[model samples]
Target: MTIDSVRGAPEPELVQLLTPEGERVEHPDYPLDVTAEELRALYRDLVVVRRIDLEAVALTRQGELGIWASLLGQEAAQIGSGRALGEHDMVFPTYREHGVAWCRQVEPLNLLGLFRGVNHGGWDPAEHGFHLYTIVIGSQTLHATGYAMGMQRDGVLGTDRAGATIAYFGDGATSQGDVNEAFVFASVFNAPIVFFCQNNQWAISEPLERQTRIPLYKRAQGYGFPGVRVDGNDVLACLAVTRKALKDAREGQGPTLVEAFTYRMGAHTTTDDPTRYRLKAEEESWKLKDPIERVKAYLVRNQLADTSFLDEVDAEAKQVATALRKACLDLPDPRPLAMFEHVYAEPHPLMTEEQERFAAYLASFEEASA
Candidate 1:
């Protein structure tokens, strides 16, 4: 059954700039003026990020990674929202936010290492303005709320130099107490944050219908914050809506909940079998609304990008996949004791003692073997 049928209600109006047929439509509320160059760049971002995702899935299948969460059909929701962030803005992302990580300049290899059990996303969050992926259901929302409050206290809110924070979560996370608590805190404190929810239709096996009776975005209204639903498949609409939301937060307008209504075209992760719960026909229907293909069509229809440009993008995607594979293969396994090293900022006596004891234990193994 389609998501609309599951809701048993009419689908709410979504902010859309592009139709499934590749025709660009105008939205009075969210106006987006993009040049040909910008369009090309956005298309490139979508294509490259998708390639990286595909490669990661391939690696997992090849036993290079223990597990991987695929973002097969949520490219526009991610890349569009990711690209909307300001340079100084911070982002808290869920485990499946590889696309946002890419926009934040976190290398794909760093993500691969996390899945491979080598390290906890080797890149520093402060350096990249992107927090490490949060595997917990919805805890990152609290972290983002706290950080945004911190920014407000630091006298950064309502300024031209304001740096807003965005917390990325899925539809499933909305049900978590942590997410609800975050909304309350953000609203009461007027935290300069944007809660970007990529509602990809399924939170694992549970469909969107099971998550809530009303639409996900509307949940924000009760919390006293503005909420918007955007066509997650339309990259331009996502970009426009997110840009406005971030701008509003920076200007001290408080939190905004942006629901990017999209679908998951593949299994939730490499470990999932979508065929068991969702219908094959449903998947085929969403395929027609493919985000990348729409952008390509728009480009081709306008004669902005010819076959040569398309071929170049495909070639570039292959090169990126090659580099990512090499990087993943070259990663060295961390020593067993490495995990204890970064547990605290300053070395504590108890930790040091434990580390020594662990070292002794490891040494005893070598002695026994000898």
Candidate 2:
């Protein structure tokens, strides 16, 4: 389907609270009551998250990271939804959600460790309420669904103290059977979970047309839940929509699908080349709708933040990037045998034998050197 066709007819118009020129607008269904201080904080979040993403991309090019999935244009989508989350809410993220990880108070170094080949996950998930990154496409959705069901069984639903779960995936994941199954389970059980799909225009090299003819959020209607498409570049809209969806889930209103309509400004990952499949014109058009630039413009136009504040934020971003670089380079590489250590909960004879043989092989190398 062409962009004009999708934007024109059967699908609903995108929900937006902030214009590309930085003017704030009102939404009847999704209202926001943000203070000036909170708005400034959101701007800080967008700046820092973008910096972290750019730094990771640079590090991957420098051979510090094996690969980096850059979330260049989706900062507002992530930060807005992430900040809407309550302290007890759980989040299951796909590998590219660096911005969400930041909002969860996860150290950038911990995330880098996974891509740097140091560990599967370097931090405790329970402590931060953020699960380990799932590289398998769409698998985390099922995990989030099951976790939400557990919360329901434990009588945690419909209470102020109750918490909901969020499943972060991409446009590509919506095509996966696992994600569809997750939707079925969540709907039938009336589970308190939010399915946040960041439709970044392209899923790898494939255009969104390859995924579905209809807008993705519309799929939720068939499964018996409400779905809304929001201007992912507009942080205010994303924040308002997500906060409302999450609140509904907490009140036992059931699952909601939040389609964050945004763009992927960079390649799918450090290794891929967008030039191979996408046009330069398309990229240029998105530059004008950049998430960070609009937020910065809004802050300046309203005098909520001055030049000195912006300069300070920029300096702070530089420090964060520098620290991330140092942490990535300083990480210790795991031993070859470390991979087999967690293969099973209890020791097995075959694994034991393999470990022994591997140890003997290393010993022989030392003996020869000596």
Which stretches in model 1 have alpha-carbon errors above 4 Å? 1-9, 349-357
Candidate 1 per-residue C-alpha lDDT over 298-317 given as tens digits, one digit per residue, 9 for 90 to 100: 99999999999999999999
**On residues 9-59, what C-alpha lDDT tens digit does candidate 2 reach at each position?**
655778999999999999999989999899989999999999998999999
Each model's TM-score? 0.96, 0.96
RMSD of 2: 1.6
- The local lDDT score (0 to 100) that residue 32 gets in candidate 2 is 96
What's model 2's overall lDDT?
A: 0.93
Cα deviation at 122, candidate 2, in Å, is: 0.8
